[model samples]
Target chain A: MINDNSEIILSVRDLRATVDGTEILKGLNLEVRAGEIHAIMGLNGSGKSTFSKVLAGHPDYEVTAGEIHFKGQDVLELDPHDRATAGIFLAFQYPLEIPGVSNRDFLRVAFNAHRKARGEDEIDVFDFDDLIEEKLDVVKMDASFLDRSVNEGFSGGEKKRNEILQMALLEPALSILDETDSGLDIDALKTVAGGVNQLANADNAVVLITHYQRLLDYIVPDFVHVMADGRIITTGGKDLAKQLESRGYEWVLEEFRAGVTA
Target chain B: MATVSDVSVLRTADQRDAYLKGLVQIAQAAVPENLALEEVRSRAASFLNEQTFPSTRQEDWRFTDLSAMLAIDFATTGEASVTEADIAELRLPETAGAQVVVVNGRVSRELSQLGSLPEGAVVGSLGDRPELQSQLADRLAQASGNHEVFTALNTVGFTDAVVVWLPRNQVVETPIQIIYVSQAQGDSLLVQPRCLVVAESGSALTLVEDYWGNSTATHFTNAVTELWLDANAQITHSRIEREGTGTFHIGKTVVTQARDSQYIGVAAGFGAKLARHNWEIYQTGEQTTTRIYGLGAISATQHADTHSLVALSHPHGIVEQEHKAIVDGKAHSVFNGRMAVAQKAQLTNASQLNRNLLLSDQARIDTKPQLEIVADNVKCAHGATVSQLQSDEIFYLQSRGISAPQAQRLLIYAFAMEILDRIPVETLRSRLAEAITQWP
Candidate 1:
């Protein structure tokens, strides 16, 4: 139902960010349209994770020069929590383990926070129980996981699944998955990717930041952008991922350098 | 161990001399006469006359300075007149139990509820009960020796006491609640409340003690509680102190456990301008278990200290102690935990942990965990940690749509839940959680 004519959900132009006085993101440009799955592939230390953190308004990452507009509002002025309530969700690669806090309680607070931000009535505990029960099925998680502390002693795959579970509950307009497939096994990868594919629709967009091409095999991307040296060097269709997978990034780097000099 | 010259120098005009003078005046006016505890009280009074208040030079009183408390000239007074309506307002909401009210160091019989208790269990004023003379003479002041000046002072000046006695093989289904309320009429007042709990062999009891007072007046609450558990006896003791911010509170709890006995203590300190609690436990017989968990939250120029000592003189004893303090604003928290295992106490397992969370840059925490094991076969471990809120943890919660303040509160509650969850009473646990959430 969605095509290139769909509305733009996120737009970033000439973004420059620094952490601890060291610049990581330099003059980066990106745009995400509604209903499209965009995959950003890059080598190590290519500012892939920094971009996601900057969009989420992490306090440590300072935006030196950039313009970020989310849903027609300047996102740079909003706090991280405000960004989240405004329908932006970031799935962390390494989820924090908060001991003594039940996962169900955490989910309830997060769900109600988004609803309250939209001027809607907050659901009670009983209604929330029923609502969260349905969201658990999206990630194929057992109901018993709700009773334990949030990621206190969960396995690698379980943490990732919990992240996706939260994304499902918030129902964000733009969801960014940052290396969510790194620590997972083949079975867990299929489950998480399947969950993401099911949640993607004509109204919401998803951005996958990964280093490997195997994830594309499960949830095909509408566009693949290869990033190097803090900027996107090339953009192509789905075949570009295959080409990079078979030939590696060395040829792409050499061609980019040659083009830059010419 | 002072020389004649040093003694003469100390005998000159000083803060200790001022306190000694005040103690004499109070003893002359406040000491009750011709009771069953006459000899015990006399001996404690003599000990108090010879001793002086501890200064910062002493090891135990190093971190907790009493200069400000000592500066105030407090008067020891009898019971303050309080109406039934006043007592009703201080009762815990939705609580079902046998409640005992103590106002200004005297037990209020009309306000106490004793009909719910079993026949064998006794909950009455120490001044009215002459039948418990022998039991009081034997167990009173047994755990806390004359070394600590404050405990000795409490024994000397206490007008009346509350006794909760469970006879042999008796088990009480409901918890016994003791509420101590302090009120000042005009001047700065001092109140000393004494509690004695004796659990006979094969008996079980759960006791809750609450300390609260008026917020408009300046007062000092000095309390002492002695617990004696016979063989195979079990007792769960919970003490909650939430006095006014203008008040000074100093409390001491001494527990003695016999063979096959179990003792669990949950102590929370959340009030007072200067609050200090000293917990001392003595293991007399083998195969005894002791668990002590404490939480202290102080803010806005308040100072709170918890000092605990567990001595294992018997074999096959187990002890676990965990104490945490959350300090904000300009408050200061201090914890000193000591575990001593004797040579005869083989196969003893003991562990002590002290964790503190500082919420402000100006807040401070001093934690010292000491473990002494004379037996080679004993397993004893101790740890202490002080940290601020992790930025990443806060950010992680914020990224989930939770605001910064909500995230910090959730993290703090979670940090305290480690000990709060172990409380047996459901209402008290939730009440403490609510207090933690509402703390500024």
Candidate 2:
């Protein structure tokens, strides 16, 4: 599905950002195209999550210098919701528990917001119910989750599935899944990965951020990236992920250090 | 700021006694010739003579300043006509036939729609039913409730009182509704509305008391409601205070629970320049249960206060209470919940919480959870919190494509819905929710 004629969904050049007066993402660059899956692998403090948040326009991350272009349109000036309605989706690392807002209501409001942005009429409750039920099937979710408050009492696995369900509903062109497989059991991870695979198409792309390579086994990525100290140190084909899996990250750090010295 | 300015507003002894004595005279003039009510009015009138207008100097009225009421002169309910169309929107379809409408504190028979009642169940004015009238002489205003100034004033001069009585083991199928509307003619009036409910052993019923101002005239509404639950009886009550902006409403709801009886009350206040609700519950028997939930949403210069007391006197008593306030603009909201566990009330379990959300920098909130537990074997927990909307919650909503302002509205709705959901009537719950969302 990697077509040379496909348009680029996301292009970040020299992105520098900070939070609470501390620089986190420093001089990072990346590019994502249509129908391609890229896995950004890093250690816990390698700034992978901060990169995803900055791309999604989180308020806390102040981009001091950089340019974010989505479909050749500058997105750094956009608000988080405006960016979301402009077809960029970020699955949070920890989904919030809204105690009184129903899941069905939340999903409908989100869907209608996207619809309004697209100049389409908002769907009624009955129609939205059918639409959400269909998307729930993509994540193997039960119908009872729609009646409860949004993520109020959900387990780790259920919250992940709910996020995926929202992604399936919004149908964004560029998706950033932030640690979607962290808290899931084997079965839940497979189900979540299966849903992502089902939604992948030639016109859409996904950027997966994870600390482990186990998720790449189910949803094969076209590129695997290794990040360190707020920069992507090295990137390679899918085989590099396997090599990094067998030979620990310290080996790559030493090799990187040698290359830098030479 | 308000405390400093209110220092000079305190009334002298002559002014206090004169203002209260004037109100007592107005109430006594409206008193009917019924012999059954004469004794109650006489006793309350004697008590009201020595009382005066409450000021900010008093402990109970510290955060509440009633000096503004000194400027207005209130009259009796003289020929005030309120048609059905005035209260059509306030009526709930759930209580279609089992409803009574009180206009200017007198029963408006033309507007009430009490279709039918069971053989032992009675729902109507207190004077119409002889059985309730006989019980009213002994049961009304019997509890040692809070704010004696207002309750005694209402008992002395209320024109008519609504009564709900259920015999032993007679469970009413339909919920009883009492719609109290106030309308002033020519001048400002004092709308004193009263209600009494008695549930015998093994009987159960749900009651809704709605206080709605039907006119734009400035008025003073003093309301009092007394509930009695015998052994094994249950009563669920919902009190809604959405008075007019020009009105000042002060109400008292007192309850007495017998052995094994349960009482659950949900009250919400949204309107009126100054509104206060004194809710008190007393336990007389063992194994009694009480649940209270309250909410007040105010903006602009409005002031809303709720003072609640739950006294557990018997063993194995249980209580749970939660009160919330949403204050915006320069408005003020107060909540003081007291839980008193006596020595005889062994093994009592009680918990209380008061949470306030200040939406503006100028808004004010005063909340206190007082626990006085003399019994060493009892379990009691109390807490209070004052905060604005969480930044993370708003961002979480915004991340989902909802705009910031809409996200704030959604969060406020969610915060208040916890108490609004306890309302038994579907129409009533939705209406109150809508009002909160539409609050300015």
Candidate 3:
């Protein structure tokens, strides 16, 4: 029940997804083993977000046909909340604004749900307060944030930091940071990356779905994958991210086209 | 009594006479021999004679259509006895402090629980208390400027109503709950119930009114509640209207807050065939604050009108009002809220907002939020919005694996959360949420 296997934490084969009846991801395949950080980079509309959303089981996108395995269990049948409770955390690119639920209450509910799903005893309120206090130090979040509504009027950097704070609380096996670095300044990015790094361990894997390579400079990745037209076109070591950063996505497309023509 | 009754325009006139005649009879039987209530009774009688029931011609009564109530040949459902079933249904968890049961406009002592009160705390029917007549008797029938004929009617026709008094430095820990239940059977039954609450200096108390009815017989309910909070006094009041079908109900409440006093009014309108509630709050003293939050869910062919007007007549006064409604089927709902700040009411801060959700194509909602400021230093703002659910929000929720209906429900709940979350009482908020969730 704890997913003790040391093999792959997540596997995807020929994942095709559609949003609002428009096909976004044609065919995508990737595998992530334990203790690895993967960075995905591509141009806008290249299906980077679609892949992350499909994995997280977002409601609007329907999979015509695909195979996704999380800890050797089928994940396509799970709901978003279920996926979240099943050791899969998705840091939304734009977190929802829930006006009445406080940040502390939301974190507590999410944390306890995952713990219960893992067959562990639910965290007591006192223990939760202690645990959350410790995690807040990693993000440098003030205590006032615990009383405010969930992401209501939160700044871009604060929202991203809150995401990492939640990640520290949930401790998921395969955490997907969906463009978590979009709205952060350099200092905020460093602080957020530091929180993420502290949560990274041998038992879990991280997927950094991003467009810029700047975030990769802070949170170094083991593998870099290039997605084009809803499919993963190229995969390489961390050097690939640097190469893409200098040459842009058009260079890789030109090289691929040249290979096809030849 | 008038000599001749030409039934044409004399319908309201004759009704007024009959109402006064019944009140006089009840006063003779119920009031104590030594209580000097003749002046209060005469003033109410004269006020009733000068006022006329509002018709469709008046803008405030345009959508209400009280013609059915005016034309109904109804007799007063007076001195009705409460059955065991009626007593059994008068139970509410938060009403453990002091309870008063009014059946068909008459107080039932056997069904009430008048809990122990602090020194100088008084709880009895307004008509039964001749001592209070010396102070609040004249202000009870003062002109409200607006043509609220029902309030005048209630003032004249009220047979039995509760009057609560909290003296200086006394705090009533338990909320005094007045349960108004309509058990009148058959058609053409009418009832006018009145309730008054007065909290003196440095006193703190809470009052709750739970209104309901059994029989579906066609009837009219003219109800009024007057609240007066003296200097440094605090009052929290909540009312629930669960009237049955085939009932034409009108409720008017006037709350005047004094210096450094705090008053909060929360109302939930759940069931009514045609119901209208008028809430008027006037801050007559400096540093007073009043907050009113209301929720209404009307469906089918029913009609509900909820109007709130708050006036800051003194400097450093504050008023906050928010109302939300969910209208479905062919029902029509109206919310009119206005905040007025007088010239001398500088440093006043007032805000009003009305938000509505139209669930069906045929459902209609009319909301008007206004702020009239004569003071240059006051801060005032008002806004009203009427719209259906957003498709993108719905799709977003659905994409998260929530079903269509469930997603809509959550969005509706989110829309109403602004007011629901503001409620100070947690259990009542949850109960209100449960009621909204179970809406058919």
Rate residue B199 of model 3 by lDDT: 88
Q: Candidate 2 residues A97-152, lDDT tens each?
A: 98888999889988998899889999999999999999999999999999999999
Judged by DockQ relative to the true structure, which candidate is superior, 1 or 2? 1
Locate the minimum summed-lDDT window of 10 residues in model 3 chain B.
Answer: B23-32
**Model 3 per-residue lDDT tens digits across residues B1-440:** 55555555477656645654554343344433444356655566566556555666578877777766545566774446676576665565665647888877767777877776665788877655666766765456553522355675565456776888888989887777788888664566677778878888999988878788866777677788888888999999888887878778889888878899999888878787899999898887899989899888889998999978888889988788889898999999988887888898999888778888899999999887767889999888788888887655554343333445765776667666666676555556677777676774
Per-candidate iRMS values, in order, are 0.5, 1.0, 4.7
**Which sections of candidate 2 miss by over 4 Å?**
A250-262, B1-13, B127-132, B214-216
Arranged by TM-score, best first: 1, 2, 3
Instruction: Give each model's whole-structure lDDT.
Output: 0.88, 0.88, 0.78
Judge candidate 2 at residue B86 and give its lDDT.
Answer: 91
Question: What TM-score does chain B get in every candidate?
Answer: 0.94, 0.95, 0.88
Cα RMSDs of all predictions?
2.4, 2.9, 5.6
Which pairs in model 1 have colliding backbones?
none
